[model samples]
Target: MTRMLLSVERDAIATAARRVMARCDELARMSSSTEGIERVYLSPEHARVNRLAAEWMREAGMSTRQDAAGNQIGRLEGAFGPEAPALMMGSHLDTVPDAGRFDGIVGVLMALEVVRMLRVPTADGSFRSPFPFALEVIAFSDEEGTRFGKALLGSSAVAGTWDAEWWNLTDEEGNTLREAFREFGLDPGRVGEAARRPEELVGYLEAHIEQGPQLDERGESLAVVSSIASARRFQLIVEGEARHAGGTPYDRRRDALLGASEAALAVERICSAEHHMVGTVGQLEAYPGAVNIVPGEAHLSLDLRGEFDGTRDAVWQLLTTEIDAIMGRRGLRWKAREIHAAPAVFCAPLLQDVVRAGILSTLPEGVDDPATIFSRAGHDGMAIGAITDVGMLFLRNPDGISHHPDESVSSGDVARGIQALAEAVLQLNADR
Candidate 1:
């Protein structure tokens, strides 16, 4: 059978996919959990994985280093030498608790593979990388925020947005982020050094799984992301008087838990009514809890996300109105504290065109168009957007799962990812 890719290119793509798969499995095994995969930022597992990734980067003909924020970085020079401006490619290395294998790690591995393919001969037997820009693979140390309750720490540092106050953020074990950095051999004071200048990068491209099922539902292997949703997170507290459950009748008692439950429902209703908006109450707790006690207070966490800031704020406005009404009706007091906010980011048009060409190259001529997904999930790109234009390609996740052990990606998609990435590099240089 005839192949669209040259024999060597096919071999490289296949080899790269297998290598990525192997590396993901290896890193998964290095997790902190005994039962499932759990590797937090700046932990022992984080250090070990950085070493492993650095080793792989070196093997693939790149100069590797760990940035001041503890992110693993590898730079591969192109036709020009080391100082040449580079196209930054990568995703985070951090994972949520009991995480799956492929969420962030796959992107980092795919980045390395792209560089490997660049170093080899093309169909025309070219010795040099087709692109004018060099390539850099970054395994960002913290995007999940499972430990510090703050995402994009590593990428933020690289973007020169490092929050000095984050050093005091603590974990479940009461270990401050500053202490964790010290334990991981990273100097907290030097984190500013991780920041990269705007002129140093050509742009950024990230390969990540479509955390939602759009690609799977559309029967496509990949999707080019158009935008990542803006997000706002809040801590909600509902206060009421505690009383003996047996003595407190439903009509007579002030139940904070019930009030909080209504607030959560209001969030869902308000957010769902808005186009492409999502609101989730991911955490909830009641104080002085007992089987028979009327809860005195309820605390819940809310995460609201939308395609645009105006639309998201509209939902928030409606939600707050509903919250006030709910509190007033329940004779309870409620408060909301904003904790995190990330604005929506649209991919650059030029980079999107390039990625579209890359996707087309992997498919048969005149085949169906690849899907375009609006990403509701967050990524390092949001942080990197501060420094340069950004684009992303999404691999299909059949189960539409994430942040759990069941998250997965197909080997075929991995191979296609390699091919598509190589084509993107060629297209960018060709356009220049």
Candidate 2:
């Protein structure tokens, strides 16, 4: 059996993580969304973050460049020639409104660590070491899609699934995605060129915070993700007669708000029927929302997630069926729009095995045993897995809160994650 070649410096990893976390705070404050820190799509703040990432990549000895779609690529060449399949790793830089410090930044910075570790010279002035595959750290743009109501735009483009029609998608201010790209010094028409050939990539890996209570509850520093849950979203609009709240008798009035409430309740009931299924009414808007006016129309956004596609579809069907029945009986008009959907992703087993072995080997001798868990959240690794082999390692968050300012991970946990990642990468390239 080949021994793992783990040479990462503990101090170096910690310092790099702190540096990245600090940068995360800075970026968050700069992009504060209308909801709070809105670095949506090609916003000015998005451009600024991308430039900062490129500069950091260059400082770490990687040759960096931005693709037509504005996805930043930081390349670290291997001892082998360009023909060798490249080992790619990275996550998005964008975040939701009022997002926390870590979210996507941790994975990008950890990938940078791999480059930093390989570039440092040994005591004899020799290059540290080279792997068989070149490494590329990519900071994907617009993963949150908070601006255009579309998520995973950057990764979708790279995967050859970006729709050109969405280039004209405008924000609340009527600024088209293309216009924003131009303002940010990017060319929108060339997005398709960013699609990468599968042969060029051997595999991909991402290290991120658990963003949930799994690892924290389990007391594990590292979690090898086995799969990512699927997500489906629906938009429901209920229309009823407008009337004064006092003038319309409750028995005779067709209240859109009442219809919306019924639909929400139905969703909750459906989710309760299945294990691992979740349904949420994240956004609800009443037309002419007023203190004394009966709501004439109500719009609801339903977000559903589950471990399997069938479960997600079942929940969606249940909602639509209930909505139809309620609308017909209450004499209210209703319509449903399917917004976004992605199937559950099962990671490459080989890569996951490597990650598990690495964590088990490098963890402190007396620490708690590590656990492998399935991720309920979708990640860039989900898209990458569709194109090439992909694996993920999640660090334990103290409170399992992510995407908020309070999200945090302990320094020791971060260190363990770095060591495990380094070992995994080295093991993957042992023969080189």
Candidate 3:
């Protein structure tokens, strides 16, 4: 393992990390929102970043192209040829509203750095691949689903899981996905061409920020991702009678807002008790703006996740029972509509070992093993896992805050992550 993950110079690591940081700053300026970052799917910002990423990938000695689904792809052919199975690495470029600079952005840039470090110059003044398999770095265009309410659109296309129904999905501006595709200079009819066959990929490895506080709390800079959590999202509605707030007696009134609030609390309580389970009520709204009227309808969004599917579903069942009881006591009715669901994507054992070895290579003399974690946040791997084996490395984020402007990663961690991920790629080559 140590032989596979050869030591990288500290200066090289720092230089790669600085380039990544500077690129991140450049991308931050290409946002849709004036106040904070808001680059969404197929937007002008997305186009700009794709062009920029392609330029950087070219500088790293890879030929670049944009896929039919709008994903930016850069390919460095191996000794076998252009058709050879390739090791793929990348993450999404799209971000949630008011997003952090280092969520998915860092992964794409790190992959570019890895390619830069590995690409060899030939006598003909052309770049040559150092390994038997090619290296492909991708910048997925729509992993956040910020514009169209469907996450992983870019990765799903690459995984050959593109849904035709998604063509009708509309953005906030009422532009259909089909229209948006054409407007972005892509032919929707050709989107299927973007899908890659399983034989084309050796495997996929991604490096991303932790998006949580576990590594920080442990005083660690990086971790091996064991798995990504299974997630389910729902829009819950609570219905009750609308009546005069002042005239109705306490016992006679049915308050939907209060019932929904109680159910939200129940979600938190139940999930907290279950290991690796988490539930959040991120959105809530009550109908009837008048203060004098009892709220007849309340809507809330529930985001539930767990390490395993069974445990996550079981917790949801328990929450349903508890919510039923609460609504019964409040004389309100409740219903839930599942908005999105994804099964957990576990890292392949081979890739996990490689990533672990990579992390160990960057550790001090006395350290033996790297920390392992299950990601609570979703990633493009969840979609790409349908086609090929997937693995991930995680860098620490302070306080575990994500999807906000305050989301941050340290320069030292970024340097370490670049070395670790590059070493992981080399380790993979050796293992092969």
The predictions' CA RMSDs to the true structure, in order, are 2.7, 2.8, 1.2
TM-scores of the models, in the order given: 0.96, 0.91, 0.98
- The top-ranked prediction according to lDDT is 3
Poorest lDDT segment (10 consecutive residues) of candidate 3: 1-10
Show model 3 residue runs off by greater than 4 Å.
Answer: 2-8
Ranking by TM-score: 3, 1, 2
lDDT of 3 by residue, 105-192 (tens): 9999999988887788888887868888999999999999989999999999999999999999998889999999999999999999
Better of 1 and 2 by lDDT: 1
Q: State which candidate has the highest TM-score.
A: 3
Candidate 1 structure quality by residue, lDDT tens digits, 1-432? 123343458876887899899989998998888999999998889999999999988887777899999999988777676667889999988899899999999999999898887774446543334456788899999999999888999999999998888889999999999999999898988999999999899889999998998888888898889999999999999999899999878898899999999998888888877789999999999988888899999999999999998899888988998999999999999999999999999998888878888887788888877888889999999999999999899999987999889999988899998788778877776775
**Judged by lDDT against the true structure, how good is candidate 2?**
0.80
Query: Best to worst by lDDT, what's the order?
Result: 3, 1, 2
Model 2, residue 384: C-alpha shift (Å) = 2.2
| Candidate 3 local lDDT, residue 59 | 88
Which candidate do you rate higher for TM-score, 1 or 2?
A: 1
